[model samples]
Target: MSSGSPLLADLIEALRCLPGVGGKSAQRMAFHLLERERERGLKLADTLHEAMQRIGHCTRCRNFSEEPMCTICSNASRDRHLLCVVESPVDLAAIEQATGYRGQYFVLMGRLSPLDGLGPQELGLDLLSERLGEGEIEEMILATNPTVEGEATAHYLAQLARAAGIKPTRLAHGVPLGGELEYVDRGTLAHAFGSRLSVD
Candidate 1:
C-alpha cells in the first residue's frame, strides 16, 4: 500500500468508479474534496448515502425516484400522450435539460447486444409491453445513444412500438456522430428534438 493515508486513496479509487472518470480526474477530485471544508465533504457523503438509501425505480416509468412514481410520471399537467424511452436515468436527465419534452420515460438498463448476450428480456422490455397496454401513450421517441448498441435498441423498440400501434421516432441529426445523448450540448439536443424524424 502507498504511504499516504488509506482513506485518501480509497476515496480516489471510489470516485474513479464513476463512468468516464479517469484515474487522474478521480485523483484530482479526491484532492479537491480533501481540501474542501469539512462540512462540504461530509455533506457530499451524506447526500450520496441518503440518495442510495431512498431513491429507487419509479413504478410507472422505471426512472429513478424517491417516491413510487417519478415527478414526470405523477405530474398532473405534463403531457401523458408521448413517451420517451432512453437507455438510462442519466439520459433521461440530459433530455429533460435539453428539451421541453414533458412526457413520460422508460429507462432500459441495457441495449440489444446479441454478442454481449444482452437482449430485450435482459433489458426489461416486457415492462414496456405492459406500459403500452395502459393505452394513453401515442408516440415514443427513441433517444438511445448513437452507438451500435443504441441503434439496435432503437430498432428493437421500433418493432415493439409498431406492435403497440404507437408511432416511433428517432432523434434528428444535430447530435455529433457516434456521440451519446448525455454528451450532446443543450442546443444540439433541442434541435434534434424539434426536427426528429419518424423511424417507422
Candidate 2:
C-alpha cells in the first residue's frame, strides 16, 4: 500500500533493510517516526550513519571497534593466556555478561557453511593461526553455537588449537539449567544424557 508519496514509500522500504523487518513492520516504524518521533528518528539516522562510517573490525580479535584495538584487547588486566573463540560479537557479549571470563577472544564472524560460501578463509582462520602461533594462549574455548554448521566450525577450531599445542575446550551442550527432563526436546535430552557428569 504505497501512500502515493514516493518519499514515504522510500522511507518504509529503507526500514525493511533491518533484520526481521517486513513490509508491514517497516510501514509501522515509518509511520511512528513521522507521527511522533521525528526528532528521535533524526538522531537515530545521524548515529547510524556515524556508526556505519566509524565502526571497523578489531585487527586482533575481529570484533567491531572504532579504534584499531578494542577495549577488551587493550585491557591489560585481562588474561592473555586464555582465548575464547566465538562465532559472533553478540556471543562474546553474552559470555562477558553471563560469566566471569576475562580472556581475549577471536570472533569467527560466521560459521562453516559451504553452501552459503562461508568457509575457514571467510572466518579468518589465517589470522587466528597467526595469533595461535604467538604462544601466549594456553587454552582456546570453542563457544560456537550448537547447530550443525556451528559444531563443524567448532571441530575445525579445536583441531587448529590442538595443532598449535593449546588445549581446546567446548561449551557444554544440553538441557537448560532449571528445566525438567520430560519437557526437554528429544535431541537435547539425549545429548544431556550422553554427556552427563558425575556429581561431587
Candidate 3:
C-alpha cells in the first residue's frame, strides 16, 4: 500500500493493475497523470469507462466487440471453413498482422491452468466443440502461446477437433519455446504459420 495522500495512493495502486507495471512505474504514472497531464488522465478515465461498458466478447469468437460478432467473423471474404484458436485477442491480432491467414478465429482469452482454476470450461472448450460439430470448419489451427499450459490446451483441443472430424494443425516451432505470439516478429509469425504441422 502507498503512504502518500490517500487519493494519490489509490491512483498509484490502480495503475499497478496494468500489465508490466510495478510499484515505481505505477507511482511515476500516477504522478505524471496528476501533475503533467490531468486532462489526458480524465479523458483516459472516461474512455476506459465507456469502452468497458460498451465493448463485450464476440458471441462466436470471444474477441472484443461492440457488436455481437467481430469484424473478422462477420466478413464474408474470410474462410468460414478454417478456424484458428489463440490464447488471447492479442495473439489473434499478431497473427493477422503478420500472416495471410484469412480464416475466422476463436480467442480462448486464456489457456488451461489448473492451478489458476483455468480449465476447459474456463476456456469455453464446450463452445469450441459445438462449433467443430457444426461441420462448417474443415480445419482448426492451434495458435496458442508456446508455453506448457498453451501446449496442453492445444493438445486437448486437438483431440476435440479430431473427434468432431475436423483436421487440427499446430503452429510450427519457428515460434521459440515458451514465446508469446504478441512479442514474435512478423517474419517468425509468417514462417510459423506457413510451416504449421498436423496435430491429428
Best-fitting candidate, measured by lDDT?
Answer: 2
Q: Tell me the lDDT of candidate 1.
A: 0.87
- Backbone clash total, candidate 3: 0
Tens-place lDDT per residue, model 3, 1-200, is 64658988888888988999999999999888888999999999999999989999998999999899989999999999999999998999899999999989999989999999998898888888889988999999999987788989999999999999999999867888899999999987997899898999
In angstroms, give how far residue 183 of model 1 lies from its true place: 18
Candidate 3: TM-score?
0.75
Deviation in angstroms for 62 in model 1? 1.5
Ordering by TM-score: 2, 1, 3
What are the TM-scores, per candidate, against the unseen true structure? 0.75, 0.91, 0.75
Task: Tell me the tens digit of each residue's lDDT in model 2 across 93-179.
Answer: 999999999999999999999999998899999999999999999999999999999999999999999999999999988999899
Instruction: Give Cα distance to truth, residue 59, candidate 2, Å.
Output: 0.7
- Writing each residue's lDDT as its tens digit, candidate 1 over 64-167 gives 89999988888998888898999999898899898888888899876888798988788888889998878889999999998878988898899999999999
Q: Which segments of model 2 are wrong by more than 4 Å?
A: 1-4
Clashes by residue pair, model 3: none
Report every candidate's CA lDDT.
0.87, 0.95, 0.92
Off by over 4 Å in 3: 1-6, 174-200
